[model samples]
Target: MASIYDFEAETLDGRPAPLSAYKGQVVLIVNTASKCGFTRQYEGLEALHRRYRDRGLVVLGFPCNQFGQQEPGDAAEIASFCALTYDVDFPMMRKIDVNGPKAHPLYAYLKKAKKGVLGTEAVKWNFTKFLVDRDGQVVGRFAPTVEPKALEGAIEALL
Candidate 1:
């Protein structure tokens, strides 16, 4: 059984980001957009990352344009926006499709591991979050509406 650690993605700066590096950490994987109404959640997510990172929580953001084209910027632009606007210190991956034929393999694995409402595998929108345990298992799927703070308890438990 392949786990989340089996996947690799590109960092916003274009470096290889292998999930295996986070094998013993609690991970919050979110598909994000810069122009969405929930874009403000970046602040909250950053807060969560700062607050729990010492306890083994890692917040990994993946910029996606599939939802209303909210995140249309290129890698450098996205990185600048996140740093200047939200002071996001957590890892941000390069833009990637979270749906359709070109969806990233990590996302495909996450969706299959934890289907959404009514067992639908498709990611409905941006900011959708997947929680992974230290053992690299997907344990929870949160909708775009769920705030990052709301997952603190769950993350703490995993840590």
Candidate 2:
């Protein structure tokens, strides 16, 4: 049924990754940016990953430069920044577009499955987050302004 397992993405190093590897794990898929105002959320996201990874929760970050070019950096640079700034240990995908024609297919499917505020499918900005269940179904969508710590309860419930 076109589950997330059907999608293949590139890692921060540009290596191919199939979502099937994360099956049966609750995943928090977030579109992120390094220079945006919402960049601080990386800390909270990493915290969530560290806290619940033992409980089968995986937080995946997908860097996107679409929103005002806030994430203008190559994979290595982004990886380094994330590691240094937030101590992020979770997996992160290569830079991708989350909206418009260049949008990644996985993101397109996620958007269709769970629209944001006012039935909008197009992402409004950076740090837009999607909560996915063990079955790879999208369960919720959080706006960019929504702080990452605010998702702890929802994430715990899913885990």
Candidate 3:
């Protein structure tokens, strides 16, 4: 029984980011893109982070270019775009493949925990979100169309 905390990834700055560091906190892990139509969702994600950070919610963004090459920027460029365009303050991870042999291990676990529509394990697009409980268990999987604000209730329940 591996918990979400068992995984590790790199931050935008290429530093190791252990999910264990987020233990006891409700986490929203989202795969993001800079040039996609859903890029504006970054603002909503930031809002969710600000609104519930004190209540034990943390939003983590992971940039991915797997889908349609929507996120073609390097780590530095992605960070700048997130900060300047959406004022995103949530922890943003380094770009990684989200749906292939090179997919991040964390993502592999998440998809196994919660499959998408029609029981598909593969992520259909960017902005897909995985919600983890305080116990480090992945509790939910949201589609790209699910707005960040709409997750307030679920986050509140975990808090």
- For all the candidates, what are their Cα RMSDs to the real structure? 0.5, 0.8, 0.6
What tens-digit string does per-residue lDDT give for candidate 2 at 1-159? 777888989999878999999999999999999999999999999988998999999999999999999999999999999999899999999999999999999999999999988899999999999999999999999998888889989988887
The per-residue C-alpha lDDT of model 3 at residue 99 equals 90
Per-residue C-alpha lDDT of model 1 across residues 2-51, encoded as one tens digit per residue: 89999999999999999999989999999999999999999999999999
Model 1 collision count: 0
How do the candidates rank by lDDT, highest first?
A: 1, 3, 2
Candidate 1 yields a Cα-based lDDT of 0.95
**Model 1, poorest ten-residue lDDT window?**
150-159
lDDT of each: 0.95, 0.93, 0.94
Residue pairs that clash (backbone atoms under 3 angstroms), model 3? none
Global fold similarity of model 2 (TM-score): 0.97
Tens digits of per-residue lDDT for model 3 on 32-131? 9998999899999999999999988999999999999999999999999999988889999999998999999999999999999999999999999999
Candidate number with the higher lDDT (1 or 2): 1
Over all chains combined, what TM-score does candidate 3 have?
0.98
Candidate 1 Cα RMSD (Å): 0.5
